[model samples]
Target: MSTIRWTEDHSRRSARWHSENHSPLPRRVVVADDRMRADHACRHAADGTALLWRGDFHNARQLLQAMGRRLDRRPPRPGSTPSESFDLHRRSRAHRAGILGKVLVLLEDDYTIALRRAPDVRLACQEAYGPPQGPVIVSLRELLGVIGARQWRVKGVDVPALDARIHPHYGVFSPVRGEYVDLVAHTPLPSTIEHRSVTTTAFDLGTGTGVLAAVLARRGVERVVATDISPRALACAKENIHRLALSGRIDVKGPCLFPEGRADLIVCNPPWLPARPTGPVEQGVYDPDSTMLNGFLTQLTAHLRPGGEGWLVLSDLAEHLGLRTRRQLLAAIHEAGLRVTDRVDTKPGHPRAQNTTDPLHAARSAEITSLWRLTSATWPPRASRHDPCAGAVRSALRRGPGSC
Candidate 1:
């Protein structure tokens, strides 16, 4: 086994040290030379080390992504059938995470935008990655995303409320899921102290970029505490809040679900789809169905004030994939000691929903995003119900668990 070492050299024009080949070390690093190799750069296991690349600035980035793909295609162990869904899912996720961690290498001072026929990504790079203090390098994959998102950010999805400007961070899921936000905005705040006195506090769980929190504040909620588990998301939310000048009304928190007190109204647009995301953006779009959603459901009762309802924003696309049945969801809610008081539904009007050429046409075409109003109730855990994947919705519904 070759020993790896980390050293800080002022001579290097890039930032961060990486190891390309430790059994436990990060598997790949982007050097000034642009070769994807297993090299160690950190001092004291990432204390001080730098990698330099030597390929076309654009291609260098593609290589990093290629390395990510390479890392993803690891062969399954012999005689180990990854068949049980939960177990397979766990293994796949662990493998993907390990590869993702390895793909992110260090950056240098003079950052080059890597891609085929790449353009000037300097501005975008500076915007997301920040200006390099000296000669340094960063994960080319991250840099490429910055450029792509920079372009996407420039051509932002118009937010009518905020003058139609939404600048998403480097790898955040863009604000394409506007339908749900619109639903929450339109849903009347159930008669609460916040509505009567205009001083009710609300919690926006998993507030990505504070979009929902900002919306809640705009909708007249006096105080909105936004909680997210991602530090980058927290920073992004803070920046957006400041940009919207709603800083006083919105407070951003990291990790914790509820802080100290219950809210008159708690709104959460947890991951709507039930699947693991392949990358960062997928995190916003997919949530392994019941993983995060289940957590939010079980804990919601403890955080909701008397007569205050928890607004759960969910999508029915999972039903299209035959992945989950409505009963499964309803049962979770009921089991959480919560009852659905009412529901407001919206049809997805995106292009893909009607695009005949899309792969997820079945789900997208018939997709519905709903805000289920949950109040206190007595729910019990029944035996698992028959799943909808067996082809008939009626049979599934008949045998399904009571979700409401």
Candidate 2:
């Protein structure tokens, strides 16, 4: 446990501190006042020195922004391919975050962050850092992020499919991306699952905001068991369920991937990328070695009733990034004793996909999000129903939001 040490000439002091990415503690630190220039700040940060800002809080923010602009102006790597450019871009952004993180801000023992233009972020801090025992130090960039997250908590993410708002707690992933949720929303329930009594149960693995679970309930599923390993996610899901008045219909639990007893339907939207998350907050976006994804596949058949269906929502961006292959995904499913019954593919409508200048735009534009319907491999694929009217409607949904 590395702690940040700051001792004034008059009083000795120390506080619980560590870099966001666990970078080595700077061997040299300088007290930066309002007079420090962006060039000088950039030089100090580039040299791996910490800058304890004693200046106005707003001014410190300006200096951090200046450093960001300087980093952005650096020349692009010459003759890099789109993939290489994408990789380089991620590295550059991370580097910038590290540099900006050196601008330190202090949190008073009373939970008041000592800086100008700083809002009362005590609730936000408590959510992320737990109750502050006493005074502590944090980066200005992170403080801003906390404030932004607080705003997000208040505003909540709107799920048009569910016709409700999912208030995301700090550290829980927000459902701003709706295409995948649409896949779950518009998906037709399994006939066996729907016809088996009035109460058909489904499990939402890694349920974040409970948006998917809520969508399932709205689509007429009677009982939904939502499970997650994140305490924050569990709380968020429960809160969202309560807000939608679906508390009785959906059960939220923590520290587990699957609930006991088989379900008629199981759905999961695991992290697409198979890399380690740099921080706790990144867990929703990156899964080291595709643990959750593979784990869900391998265990899905056992938890699914004989005629049940498993919906796996995934993206092919990893394939585009050369991280994983389509063949690998197919093999994982087969090894899990599951086979794809049908798939609904949709292109992302996010702004990044249309932004040609983005380093990963090519891959983003080429990305396809698929909702795979899975069942026991021993059981043959479901017989296709010959209904042109239904096929036309499903074809439109499969093509995505605007393809029709």
Candidate 3:
């Protein structure tokens, strides 16, 4: 809990600084009100100075928008390659967010804003920050994000596969993209493990909203265990599971990626991109160095019952962007002593996939989400170490109907 100090009313004052993204505390702070011009605010922000807003709440929002428009006037130059373009686009976005984050607001001990026209944000703040410790200072941009997340939590996202809505908690990734969920719903479940009489058991790894676990339970999996490495995600999954009345069928646990025992079926939808995330929410979108992906692959065989299968729901968008390659992915599976039995592919129907103006439109347009069925190789597998793709075989077992 870092504290930020500033002078007001000829007296020194300070408050705890809060940033979900862990941004550094401002070196300089000054009070600004309704009289502050957008250009002046931009100048202060460009100079790495923070503005403590004391004016009408709506007016502050307008000023923030004005500053954004000014920043947008000068866009980053386009790159020659898709990878370069992606890197430049990310830098531009980070720069924009940094400038806009200069606008700050203060909340009292109980999460109340003193400015006029400020809506009651106590509930939203409590949900995001837990019990309030004392007066806290946060960027106006982050505060707005918290408010928007509250609305989404209240309204919830409807999953066609589950025929229900999943309420995502603050910092938890929502299931806005339903293509992966559909693949899980439609995949054929293994009837029985080889040489053993066992009941149907499934595990959902890195379950964010528990959408896939819910889908598995609905598909008649006798017992389902959902694991996550985030406390917020675990709580969110438990709530959703309880709401769907599948609490009896599914057990939510963790701060761990994999639970204690093996399962007949293990499913994982790791983050698609192999890059570092900029914020908490992006954790679900990016996995630095493909750590989660490789972890799942390397340890997958140990957590599977004989004749059992592992379902890997992943997107080829990273490959299209040149961040990863099919050869490397196949090599990884081979080295892990796992063989790809089958794969189911689906094209994303997200608006960005069709948007021509997006910087990564080329990759998005060609993105293919797949559900890969994997199983352990026989003892003393024949594939040589140099032949990584020898055991990797991809037969299109199924193709999803249409865009989600």
Candidate 4:
């Protein structure tokens, strides 16, 4: 809990500082209002000074926009390689966010804004921050994001795969990209395994909004267990499962990746990019050092029953950006004692893919999202663990059916 202090009326007043990104508290703060010029505000922000808004709410918003326009006039320097370009773009974004975030606003004890003509944000604040503690100061940009998230929650995102809308929580990732969901929905479910009569059980790992788990259930997987490490994601998934009347067919579990027992099928859609996320919401898009991807592959075999399959829904965008390579991906699967059975690919239909002006547009346009069907290399009764032949058998199986 950090506090921010500013001088007003010849006295110093302080309020609790709230930053979701845990940014350092401003060292210097000054009262700013409608009379403040956007150019001066931009200069102060660049100098690392904070502006505590004491102006009309709408005017403050305009000031923020003005600052953004000024910053955008100067574009980031181009790099020689795709990877370098990506790095530069990320740094440019961070710089812009830092500058725009300098404009701050104060929320009263009960989550009310005292500014003139300010909209009632009590409900939105409560939804994002839980119970109001006391007077708190937050970046105007963050407060606007909170308000937008509330609207999104109220007007749920439509998912054609589920034929229903999924209302995403404040920090939970929304399934706005339907191509990945479609891949899961349309892919043929594995046939009856060795002794089982049908695909009776399934697991959806890191199930953000429970969208994939719900899709599995709707596809007639008798029992589906969804797991996530985020508390907010767990709660969001549970609520969605109940809303869709699939509670009987699905069980929401975990701060862990895998569940207690083996399942006939396991599914994972890890973060696409191998980079550190800037905030909670970005967790769905950026994965530091491909941690989640590697974790899923390494532990996937243990959680899968013999003759069962694991569906890894991933994108080649990282490869396009020069961050990862196809050979490395194949090597990972092989090292995990797993073999690729089949792969289904789809082009991204998101707007960014078509935006020619975006810095990473070339990579986005060339990206291919695939659902890789994998199975344990040593399945259906192989040599004993003590037998040296067992190692050879597993190695041979890795190159057997789907050698990439």
Candidate 5:
């Protein structure tokens, strides 16, 4: 019953087009060009062809449903994981490539909202896709996401920050991870505001929901600068900050990485696991061999004001999962010319931690979230950043996985 479909208004509707920006597609496809007779079109598509119906909008949707059900009825491969993820990922990808291989949409050169009752999605689409170049004929998924975001904006996330609501997008990483927030809010400080001159400046790196920055402000930090690279995340952060009435106090920017200037304190809640993300959403969960973590540590010394703390909220799940070691983690901190002054740990109470069905149930069950107080230091400085036996982090990209 869900209106879930991929759209590509600007993309070539033909499946044969193998373009770079576009995901890899099939070699050729057949467009139906007319109202489809279910059996006839199904048979033709079965022969490695597509049924691109130029008929009623609702009918096209109905036909897609039929095709999906038909596909679902087929038996799965032997030894398949039944959502086992590891192997299912491989099969799901292959299935996607094949089915999408046959899809072809019939559209005019300039894409337009021409359906009998298509919603007024012009503004939302423009925001996500930019001004349409000669009209963008896109996939159904993109269109739906745009319209969905519009609804979210009309409504909101009910933010206690602005005490209003911070609207979020469909795919944006929502502020569901609240454990870290509690850690930041409750953690003891290593040093009081010893500022000969109290600076209102603070920087929050990878401000996912701007929740931490909001927390910092709520804790009495004056001005906070938040930075993130993802547009969706940036939007969510801005919305949250503005809703909290901290727009005047907090500035959010799209920094490729860290922001400039010395901060009273810089905070980052990096991805906990040391693994590659399988999808766009997974980027928030998996750190891809801990690249982002290393980047923050490597750059922490430069951005932090003297005597300021770089608060790193991280989970020990990687260690619990036997993926990384604590010694290596401390070593990385040491190699970055920084030292952990203090750290406060918290246990996760999420249902997932107690769920035995999850593939990583054991690790998740034992996860420990902590806020590490970091200070720039030269103590135990690496003999060389790359010396393998030097006993710490390796090269920036290579420092994840094993040696922490």
Candidate 6:
């Protein structure tokens, strides 16, 4: 039996099974077997109950698919405000995902996951759950994700910005969303810095796979200091830099949010939303109360060299979702003592943006990603700064943080 917490209370409870889905604490969990009918199982799940399958592996998958079809035919709430409607849609999707993810699979005591047609996912599992000490139960749906992620880790994501593949670890954020990376690659370097003898250095805060850092290094930035709070992310970034033969140019550091000292340019792409993540994997997508984003803005000026620019890559989806507002963001920026000099905007061409059936489609369709070029309000530039694109490179080469 696995010891898990009952979310309602702080008490610990033991169960033979646990959910592997994104939800960490399911309110209701019930055990089921091969003898259980799919209709009965579906009804139980529809009532906000969790079904832990201990049945034929393939049958569990089929049951999950059946539940999915039912959810597709479910009607949307009518007569609700746009915000309420959007929230309802989000809830509906979350409910369906939770129900379908109940398909349970077993992990053998020897650290092997047994399921029909399942690929070898020991490495991926280790990356997530660590060495499987003994037999444990996990969600088959998540196992499938792990399997797919393993393939992604092997093949890597092709970054047009760097003209190279950035291999991401299982838990690290992948560079699948290329629009922001493209913005980073094309954004004009700030002109205030005199880029002459030594090359100007840049800082890439929250560098997950180091894609942006690699992009900066490729753009002739002499050095890049990539920082992250996760050791796993740091390791992943280092491996990618090494793979690209830019390890000598880009330095990976952390357990820290920002590298020590300052640089000519700093790039940060915080999680686009201000919401709580249910699990570690979701942290790259959802930020609680916009903590990381705010932290970057508040401390950015201190780390920027005189006349330096801080590139902030963000999306307006949260604003559309009503979770945040433009006024609130602008106020935060003002409070941080930073002012946006200019911004480059791009519309997302991802599949979700085109799917009208998606619950957040309205927001997704209207979503605009912008790279805000910002500078400290109090920092006086040595020279007049105007056209970011027409500036000549004349800065002395500087060593990045840690001088790797």
Q: CA lDDT, every prediction?
A: 0.63, 0.81, 0.88, 0.88, 0.62, 0.75
- Model 3: worst 10 consecutive residues (lDDT sum): 388-397
In angstroms, how far off is 10's CA in candidate 6?
31
How many clashing pairs per prediction, in order?
A: 46, 0, 0, 0, 17, 10
Best by TM-score: 3
TM-scores, each model vs. reference = 0.67, 0.92, 0.94, 0.92, 0.69, 0.84
Tens digits of lDDT, candidate 1, 1-404: 23223333444232344222122433333334444443232221233222434455665555555555665565333223212333454465555444434334334355553433546766776766566554333334445566787787666666655454666776566677667767776677867754455468899988877788888888888899999876667777888888889999999987766655888888888877676665666688778756778888898888877777789888887765666778788788878988776666667667778787544455577876777777777433121344322332322123322111
| Candidate 2 TM-score over all chains jointly | 0.92
Preferred candidate (lDDT higher): 2 or 6: 2
lDDT of 2 by residue, 183-281 (tens): 888778888875796468999999998999999988988899999999888888988899899998999977799899899899999999887776657
- Cα shift from native, residue 301, model 6 (Å): 0.9
Q: For model 6, how does the per-residue alpha-carbon lDDT over 1-404 read when each residue is reduced to its tens digit?
A: 45332222354434335444345544576667667776777787667666655566667767777767877887567325556766676577677677666555567765475555544667887876667776666666777677777788889999877878999887789988888888888777877444645568899999999999999999888889999997778888999999999999999999888889999999999999887665556778988889999999999999988889999999888888888888898788889999777667677778888898776678888887778788898876433466432322221102211110
The true-versus-predicted C-alpha distance at residue 290 of model 3, in Å, is: 0.6
User: On a 0 to 1 TM-score scale, where does candidate 5 land against the true structure?
Assistant: 0.69
* Predicted candidate 5 versus true structure: per-residue lDDT over 1-404, tens digit per residue: 11112334545432222211243333234445336665565566556554444455666556655655666665344332222433443465446434533434322333345665545666775555555554333434334445776687667655443344555654455555556666666555435343436756778888877777887787777788888877877887887777778898888988556877777688898888787654445567778779999999999999876677788988888787665788889889899998765555666666788787655566677676767777877534222244322333212114321111
- lDDT tens per residue, model 4, 1-404: 99899998899999999998777898799999999989999999989999999989999999999999999998888789999999999999999999999999999999999999898999999988989999999999999999998898899999988889999988899999987888888778876433487548999999999999999999988899999999889999999999999999999999998999999999999999999988889999999999999999999999887778999999889999999998899889999998776676666678988899898988988887778878898875332334221222222123322111
**Residue-level error in angstroms, candidate 1, position 235:** 0.9
Name the lDDT value of residue 11 in candidate 3. 100
Instruction: Work out how many backbone clashes candidate 3 has.
Output: 0
Write down the lDDT that model 2 would get: 0.81
> Which residue pairs does candidate 3 place in steric collision?
none
TM-score comparison, 5 vs 6, better candidate = 6
